[model samples]
Target: MRILISGASVAGPVLAYWLTRHGFSVTVVERAPALRKTGGHAVDLFRPAMDISEKMDVLPRIEELATGANRMTVHPESARRPVRADLTKIFSAASDRHVEIMRDDLSEIYYDATLGDVEYVFGDSITAISPDGEVRFENAAPRRFDLVVGADGLHSNVRRLVFGEESRFSTFIGAYLGVLTLPNTAGLDRELLIHVGVGRTAGMYGAPHLGDARALFLFRSERELDYHYRDVRRQKEFLREAFAGMHADVDHWLDELDRTPAFYFDSITQLRMDTWSQGRVTLVGDAGYCPGPAVGGSTTLGVVGAYVLAGELARADGDHERAFPAYERAMAEHVRASRGVALSAAKTLIPTSRLGVSGLAQGARLVSALPAGLSRAFLRLTTKSARLYNSMTIDDYPPSPAASSGRVGLGVE
Candidate 1:
């Protein structure tokens, strides 16, 4: 079967790897000119995602690239000293497992794993898709495929074209996030420092491996901001207005915002759809059911979704009629559970008032002061979002001849 996948990031490459292993001809089309190497924050790989990575033979590499910041310090606006928390313990209690790695590192590992086995069409995008599995691209010739899967991010072109207007299916969660790279002037080493202000949070942490520091910003908003998602100048202006005179650290970070080579800004929104498939064209990962952008375990959810989608297709002998529905059924409960956490995460991470910020700091201090065992138990008892990470079981599909053969290496030019 000839299968076409969109957005060669997290889900797309994983789907390509598994589909190719299941004896399907896979082609991936990415809008970017090349693999995106920067401008993304660190993402967690929970137990289920780790298991999938192990099966894909990339777990060791993932572990090697895991973020070294096992500690997190919270700086309150009124406090002279920051409250420190052990991130390792906090994350472990929420989910049985935790492997935090940079987003681009994970994508690079997945892309390298399947590069030789799949045909990647970079610097192009799908312009149109017909009901009969025909696809047209902006820079490539039109082609027909047995199936097309949209593993694209929140603003998916495939979802927009096949599922109609995105606004109808999108649920804004009243927040916005920005990330960029800057010089490591703070001299932080393997530690994360977060500053919390009224209804806003700004953080800077050192990335020794990359020889730079990363600045992360999050703020609350009642409604979605009106601006172009791709317009960097307008996005910077929006951020400047939202974070004006917030803190000395924020001002220092913003001083170099214009010089930063790449900057990412977007709203924290969720995509909810009654169905993710229309005929032979379907959706996976953020394109179909993104619980939340940064707060949600979106990367973990995407990896698991890609695995199940491909496994169901292989089980049904590449029959979309059977695979699509099965994929949805298997993912419905998990997706719903993950979405529930996003609502509370936004309020907790970015408090709405000065009192709320203090409350957050106090909570962190209380959690950090507890004994190791007590702390883990306390976090596990209070964090409902952590349980959602391992909510589903990944079924094993029989390996095909392609998978039994020697694996492929990075094939990029």
Candidate 2:
């Protein structure tokens, strides 16, 4: 089977890896000219995702690149001193196995794992898709494939072409987020500092592995802002306006926005689709069912989805007729569970008022002051949504006869 996957980020490369392992020819097309190396915040790989990574033989490398920050400091707008919490303890309590690695690092690890075996077409994009699996690309010749999958992020081009308008499937969570790289002037060493104001947050943390710092902004918006998703200048303006006069620290971060070459801005949104597959085309990860950006464990969900999608295909002998529905059935409940957590998580991260922000800061301080065991227990009890991380069970699929005999190899280049 010849499979074409759009977007070479986490889910695309992962799906490609499993498909090739199952004796299918896989080709990944990415819009970026090369592997994206920077400008993404840290992403968590909970137990299930770690298990999948181990199966892919990339866990050791992911561990090697895990973020070194062991603590998080919450700075309230009115407080003189910040409240610090131990990140290691918090995550350890959440899961027996947890790895927090930079998003770009994880992307590179997945890309490297598949680069030697799969065909990668960088600096191009799909313009259209036909009912019979014909694909048109902007910079390359049109081609036909047995199947097409969209692993692209929130605003997926493949989803737009195949599933129709994005607004139909997109759910705005009444907020916006922006992340950028900056200088480590905070002198942070394995620590993260977050400043919270009414309905807004500005954070600066060290990225020791990348030898720089990262600035993150999340602010509440009652309605979705009207702007081009791809326009960096307009996005920057929106961020500045939303966070204006909230804090001097935020102003400092915004001042450096124009100087930063790599910037990411997007609405805090979730993608909810009733069906992930239609005929020969389907969607995976954020393209199909993103709980919400940043707040939800989207990276973990994407990894699990890729594994299930490919495993189902292998189990069905590469029959989309059987595999697509099985994949949807396997992931439907998990997606629903994730969507339920998105709204509350967003509200917690970006509070709606000054009083809420203060209360959140006080709660953090109280949690930090509690005994270690007590704190962990308290966190586990309070964070009911964390269960979403391990909600889906992975079923192991035996390698097909062709795959077991090493029949799977690089397809026509």
Q: How many collisions per candidate?
A: 0, 0
Candidate 2 local Cα displacement, residue 102, angstroms: 1.3
Candidate 1 segments exceeding 4 Å error: 400-413
Best by TM-score: 2
Residue 362 shift from truth in candidate 2, angstroms? 3.1
Write one digit per residue (lDDT tens) for candidate 2, span 1-413: 78999999899999999988888888999999998986788888988899999999999999999986788989888778878887776777666689888899999999999977899999999999888778899989999987899999888898898889998989898888899988777788788888888788888888567777889999888888888768888999988887887667778888999898678888888998889898888999999999888888889989999999998988887778899999999988888888877787787778888887887787676666777778767766776556667455778866788676655432323
lDDT of 1 by residue, 1-413 (tens): 78899999999999999988877879999999999986688888898999999999999999888877777889988678888987766766667777888899999999999978999999999999987778999988999888899999999999999988889999998999999888888888778889898888999887557678889989888878989867889999878888888778889999889999768899999999999999988999999999888888889999999999988887777778899999999999888988888887788889988888998888777777787778767766676676566555768877654444533221112
lDDT (C-alpha, whole model) for all candidates: 0.86, 0.85
User: RMSD (Cα, Å) of candidate 1?
Assistant: 3.8
Error of 1 at 333 (Å): 0.7
Give the C-alpha miss distance for residue 326 in model 2, angstroms: 0.6
Instruction: Give the clashing residue pairs of candidate 1, or none.
Output: none
User: Given candidate 1, what's the lDDT at residue 175?
Assistant: 93
